[model samples]
Target chain A: MQIAKVRGTVVSTHKTRSLTGTKLLLLQFMDAQGQPLPKYEVAGDLVGAGVNEWVLVSRGSAARIDDGMEHRPLDALVVGIIDTVTVENNRLYSKKDAERG
Target chain B: MQIAKVRGTVVSTHKTRSLTGTKLLLLQFMDAQGQPLPKYEVAGDLVGAGVNEWVLVSRGSAARIDDGMEHRPLDALVVGIIDTVTVENNRLYSKKDAERG
Candidate 1:
């Protein structure tokens, strides 16, 4: 799993049948230091995360482990909405601070 | 799931039990134009791919779908050795050319 920031939503009508009714979110990957990387991924949003919220993403086939996601062509899935990130006991990111900012 | 070039091998004796006797390879991904990306990944080699070979990679849980690989923690697997890559009716890369170069 990797920490990513939800950038926005992706609405595609003409998608694979398995993706029907699945909400997709645009995500920007964050590095260990909590800094955003140049890489981006469009992931199925199972957690209903909002824009700018930090999320934990499960990539690849594991993304399909959730209920009703089996056999989907999804490569990425938002597994959790992150509250905070601590690295080496240092508070790298806090949702409260981000919400205030 | 993606196109990658096998750069070299990864020899790790101390690994998880499921990875015992598995051959690991260093792979660099290629963009749509067949240009090498800076990103890299260590993938399990199931097809006996060689160094500098262009190969098709299956990533995530799909990688473990192969026989004897079920329930393994593997995230990437070299699925096929590529002979060439075509883009817009033009050959973007060829294993034969790469070998000569």
Candidate 2:
């Protein structure tokens, strides 16, 4: 799993049946210090994470374990909305920070 | 999912019970052309992939869908071994090529 920030949304009119009603969000990978990396990925939102929320992006087949998500042809998934992140005892991210930023 | 080359192995005697007997292989991310990227990851192997083999790394909870793996706390998993990859009708990799290189 990796920390990431929701950057935007993806709108696809044509997709596989399994993808129907699945919210797709654009993500910028972030470091432990809550800094964005120069990397991006489109991920399926399973946790109702909104844009700009700090989320945990589960990569690999682990992203599809939710009920009804199997065989969905999804590679990345937003599994958790982080409430707080502390690295080396330094608070790096919290819901309040996301709300204000 | 991404294509990667198996680079090494990870031996962990102290891991979660679900990870017992799970082969952890180090992977170097690869471009579609079969060139290695600078990025690397440690992925669980499920398809009996071996070192130097080009395998598909499934990210997210989708990695744990295999029978008996649903609750495994794994992030990345090897799903397929590449026999041949032809992009734009240009053969970039093949089992035969991997054997020769």
Candidate 3:
């Protein structure tokens, strides 16, 4: 699993039969510090993450294993919403702090 | 694509033939605000994101398209390192800020 923000949703009407009802989001990969990473050749979305909204994203076969997702052609999915981040060195982070800081 | 830290590399010596030479990193998902998201039921890495490191990860068929990666059974791969993140609302976030803040 990777950290990403649900920038937007992917709507493919003529996709593979396995990818029927999977919700594909344009995920922007983020660093541990909650920074947006540089994108390479893939196309993603610019959803309103508000600078900090830790999100859980799944890709590959794992992505295809979401609820109601099976044998689909999905490559990614927003699986969870983050609430807080606790790191060593007495460094604690949260979505609220990311929005404020 | 998603943001993740290269916590550790996956080494499967007796796995699929297509998955040769592919580096599998245990990835911990983060939120948009840069917070860690609650994991549902996926085994990932704790390779040390250091609270801030924007790394790019590719999954699914896309992950199989990396250089020297073809017809492999790989599900994920770390493709790039992030430099900076620029969001609206005047929130200019970077790797430096994520580590410090």
Candidate 4:
């Protein structure tokens, strides 16, 4: 999983039946220090993550294997919402600090 | 794209209608040198990538927008197959070197 910020949401009205109730969000991958990484990617929303929310994004088939989400057309999902983050060895990073730096 | 090895394959028969022709693979995220990262994650297959092939996986909504794929249940997809990787600033990492280290 990678730390990311919900940048926006994607709305698809006409989609597969299995995707009827799924949510798609634009996620910007962040480094350990909370800085947006060079890569631009997004994740489908499963946990109701909204814009600006810090989330843990999972990619690939595992992203679809979330509990009760088997065999869905999902490739990425917001698997978890981060409440707090703690990094050892002085590696602690935060979105706030990242914005300032 | 991150350097990764195709670990395995996922077979799902009962699936959404839009996903009828899509392929799913088991992917393990790898670091610069091709070693699996600490996180255990997998990406769905889209580029006809096979097991043991190095691929470039995309996550989230972008994973859904590949060429003819739209509004499917895909969250992660192999968008590209890597031929070679070169990192600057002495940061060039490969799967072979990562395995050795």
Q: After superposition, how far is residue A79 of candidate 2 from its true place, in Å?
A: 20
Tens digits of per-residue lDDT for model 3, B1-101: 45444444456689776655544555665454545555311112212222335554555564454335556655554444444533333333355566678
TM-score of chain A of each: 0.95, 0.91, 0.67, 0.79
For each prediction, how big is the interface RMSD?
Answer: 10.4, 9.8, 11.3, 11.6
Rank ordering of all candidates by TM-score, starting from the highest: 2, 1, 4, 3
How far is B92's C-alpha from truth in model 1 (Å)?
Answer: 28
Clashing pairs in 1: none
**Candidates' RMSD to native:** 9.9, 10.1, 12.9, 11.4
Candidate 2 residue-wise lDDT, A12-61, digit = tens:
43333445687766677898767778666567788898767889988766
lDDT of 1 by residue, A1-101 (tens): 99988765444343334446877666778999888896666677888998789999988877889888775546678999998898889899999999999
- lDDT string for model 4 (B1-101, tens) is 34456778777789888878777777777654335765544566655666766665666664665455676777667655554444322333333454466
lDDT ranking, best first: 1, 2, 4, 3
Q: What is the lDDT of residue B18 in candidate 3?
A: 60
CAPRI-style grade of the A/B interface in model 4 = incorrect
State the lDDT at B28 in candidate 2: 96
- Candidate 1 vs candidate 3: the lDDT winner is 1
lDDT of 1 at B34: 65
Best by TM-score: 2
Candidate 1 chain A least-lDDT 10 residues: A10-19
lDDT (tens digit, per residue) of candidate 3 on A1-101: 67765454323343233334434444567778867684311223222233235676655666545445544333555566776766676444577776788
Best by DockQ: 2
Model 4 interface root-mean-square deviation = 11.6
For A1-101, candidate 4 gives per-residue lDDT tens digits of: 88887665434343344555655565668787778774534456778876676888877666767666664555667888776678775646555654466
TM-score of chain B of each: 0.92, 0.93, 0.66, 0.76
